[model samples]
Target: MGKSIRKISWVAFIASIFSFSWALGPSPLVFSSGNQKELWDELLKYKLWGRDALDFNNSNIHFTTVEGYAGTKKDFTLRNGNHIVNGHFVVGESFITDTGPHTFGDGYVRIGGDLVVTENAKNNTTFNDYVCVEGKEANPNNGVFKKGTPTLGSCPGFFPPLENDLDIPVLDLNKLSGTELADFNGGRTEHVNNGVLVIDGLPDNPEESRLKDIYIGELNINNNSTVLIHQNSSNNITRVFVNKFIYSDTEWDIKVSFDGETAIDDSTYAGTLLFYFHNGFTIPAGDRTLHGTYISNGDMILKDHLRMAGQLLSTSITIDADFNSEHFRYVPFDPPLVDPTAFANYILQEGIEGPQLINFELDRPAVIDVDLKYWFEVPTEEDVANYGEGLINANDLASGYPTSETNAKEVFFKKGQSKPTEEQTIVIIDDEFVEEFEILVLCVQIGVGASLPNGTTHQCFDLYIADDDIYLVPEVNEEFDFSVYENSEPKTVVGKVKATHEKNDSLTYAIVDGNELGTFSIDSNGQILVEKKENLDFESDLKQFVLVVEVSTIFNKKATTQVTINVLDVNEKPVFKKGADVVVDENSGEYFEEEWATERFSGSNELNNGKGQNENHPERPGEPQTFKFIVKYTDVR
Candidate 1:
């Protein structure tokens, strides 16, 4: 069904009124309109674009997943009849062309950045009829080709078609750390680099169910791996977020998704699933096929041979294959257009590290369910912007709530047991990494089935969390340096690294750098030793070593320092090769000419150029034969 759009005249008003009356009484009207709702109208008309991609004169402005405004230029191309299909191509920039006979299919082109000829795209015949493929130099031929009135600015970023203030939840993969990313993505930091990832948002029978969101810390798409966006009888959407992107080589075909329903309402899968990457990644060349929209926050590399059945959007796309219909099929996405609503009910919460602290007082002596919501950001700004009002009372707020930056997610938001709960009691954890203080705010919201008399009607209670954990940073002793001659014994501790630590706090040492070749090791006692003794070559180009060590306390407070290890030089007397000069130091050792050491060692009778009797054979790996001689020199000093 085509959408009847709404305007954003009531969003701020809804956001402002979060008192108990609104939660227990009025529900926000479900109409399609907001900063992100414009997407539905534009997509229906084939308009996908970056912000400001159109000519400055266009009235319709759209936003994208990327932040800020990006003006358009001659950035993309339509070669042959590849993208000429039952779809439209919209970009933040304008369409590109060469002087050749390029064939464009039946699809429409809406340039978000710039319009070349601008005369309504030859009455919407093709992209070239409307947008200038050429840059600011002005296509003189545009006057002759263009035929219709000009229109612009049709595409934007991650806005869902339904109401809820474009709230698809813009979770930036680049900004969040691995620990934070895993919290939202199934509470896992590692998954599916080599195995199957089954995201079954829609289950077949009653035994099956739906999934909210899937997250991956770092996803390495490989040929041997399979990613199935499992289908369901209930029409639910599948969403996945990946923090880091990498490529791994394997020897097999990779499965991307199952039958993904093309549009939001449809249960059949013809096309239009999306694989959005925050960082740049690659689709390796193979005898495999993939379906979905490929959008990247950074540059993307498309290898050859993998057939695709969806649209692709990115900052820079490098197609390392033939641009034809057999390789790519342009299918735009159709998101569900409906109203999603929310309301507020209080759920007092504290961290689950110790005993649950926030005690609840029920108004009716009955336990009621409440909704718990969370987002990653500093609590102060987040509180004011999302939940709290202006400078008001602190006593009424979440007790031990952080007004200072010291207790923010940017500083000490650690890992804890954060999960879905319907109980009135909630837990907000303060991690051990928090240095100096531990504090945070846990906001409670009522949505869907929550009601009034269970809580916020005629009476409101002051919520307080009893917390007394003061965190501090761990301290480390100075770096220790020790000198060892070449061929030092492996597994022998050269020196110990000391650190001042609390009696209750345990310290761990790790060699962060200068041990890339697996030449060094550090144990629990901060003992530095050689893992590979052969690496300590005195004559090697590197004469000194600097080991950067990282030390962490039991509380997760960390500090780093360096250890310098210098190699002492060893002098070698010249061997008797014809007329080799043997330096005879009085205190050093006895020096012998070729005549005296003829039968000294067992390997060779004569010092044949100092081969030490083992000329063609090195006794050890790099070591020749051992040279033992008697002292025959007297001190002259």
Candidate 2:
């Protein structure tokens, strides 16, 4: 049991066209020491800095410094559209304008706390780079720190604290297991075991409460609740750990959405949302504009108009209304690096190479070469021979692949054959020479076999291949026999159901089972109207009603059919069955002997059975009625 080796340069990829399965495992926090100013002061001491306006990688938090404040209120302006802030700028009672006489952007401003100036404020503050007045000295006469130089003290910290710490793993809801509590109640959980999860109203089954990495212990969210995150894209990230507080009364009705694209446009950064609050984070009144990131360990009571583009860490931040940094834009906080379960089981375990082991210190026996690259985007030979039969219209595999490279058969091993031999590592790719691309980038390159000694080293692994199309399910066009005419008037169309799809007009009709017998209604162009003509009664409804309908498509693909309908039964106008209180008391008037009857209706009595030779009235049985008798009323003397 003596075999240890380590040498990998890099080249990893894993995109065999969509396939996901990662039962929660990374990100428990692991960054021992890469020291970037001590990891930016330990991410601003756990405020986790990484704001967004794009640039989501090298742990973003831009703003090397920017301070501007001009006076003489002429429309108090500080437009700045120049934007660039890597960190360091504190405006207290805000007022920095500029519409002429420039100099306000290009960065540099340090004012730790207190720069108040409100009596309807003014302006006269400018700084293209350099204006320091932290706390310890220099007040600069209430407000006048133009274009640079104003130094004094404080302002050189910007995030730094957890060098080698590790303790955020507590999630033992009684030691889980029951398939991990049914995969955390089947939302595939991310974290949340403590307690309080109140999202107030609406969720007996909102697609099973669509969740995602939500570690809770207290997370109310009232004010007409809403917390959807149905993401099928946008890199899918939705963490919401709240170890203590996250109240919410009316920030425009405690909302948080993604999928329905909650407003603010441009796919609102496609929703990456993270709201970690270890202690306090309330939302008193209304107004909000969130893209993502809002870590608060304590104190963040924002009221009224609270616009946040992203990243707003807090230990204390109370804005009662209007704090508009032009709609609050300070995005930065890149979170997503939690690999240490032996490097996530050597890159998501599957085959088992070297079965796990790495001590390093080899003086001889060393040969670990593992290469696996599967990048796709070339399918058009009739979509690789009609891949698996139907629905094929691909093209969107993350949008970058078409240089041409296809080599799917290679695997070798020596030095005790570091585990190969399953036909030297099976690798098949012959879907009729596959092509129709949209994304399938899987790169895995781990090399080291030139007689070791750091001679051959490589490491690369990337994965993203999603564009599996195959949807063709709309058909609807089977049983349909209409008759109508029971008072027919409501909408009247009745028959026209024809659904067939290859996305033809995108389909979309419905009546699914008579619609509670509201009498039918299909329409998205599948016609079939006649909704409720008093529920169409052929003798109190149901002469033979069936309906069903269905037919969807906009990608939801569905189909159903069955119409029936047969309500025909009209004709009814001959009635004289007595009882207006008949009384031959008009001076003994005759022909008043009570029972003045003439019945013949109940599905239109067979027709024709007269007694005066000039008659033809059996409830208008085929129309030929001619049995007359006139009478006028108003002789009550």
TM-score of each model, in listed order: 0.33, 0.24
TM-score between candidate 2 and the true structure? 0.24
lDDT of 2 by residue, 267-342 (tens): 2332245566555565665664565656655555555455554555544444343334544433333221111122
Worst 10 residues of 2 by lDDT: 1-10
Candidate 2 has an lDDT of 0.39
**How high is the lDDT of residue 127 in model 2?**
49
Error in Å for residue 290 of model 1: 2.8
Candidate topping TM-score:
1
What TM-score would candidate 1 get against the native? 0.33
Compared with the true structure, all predictions reach lDDT values of: 0.40, 0.39
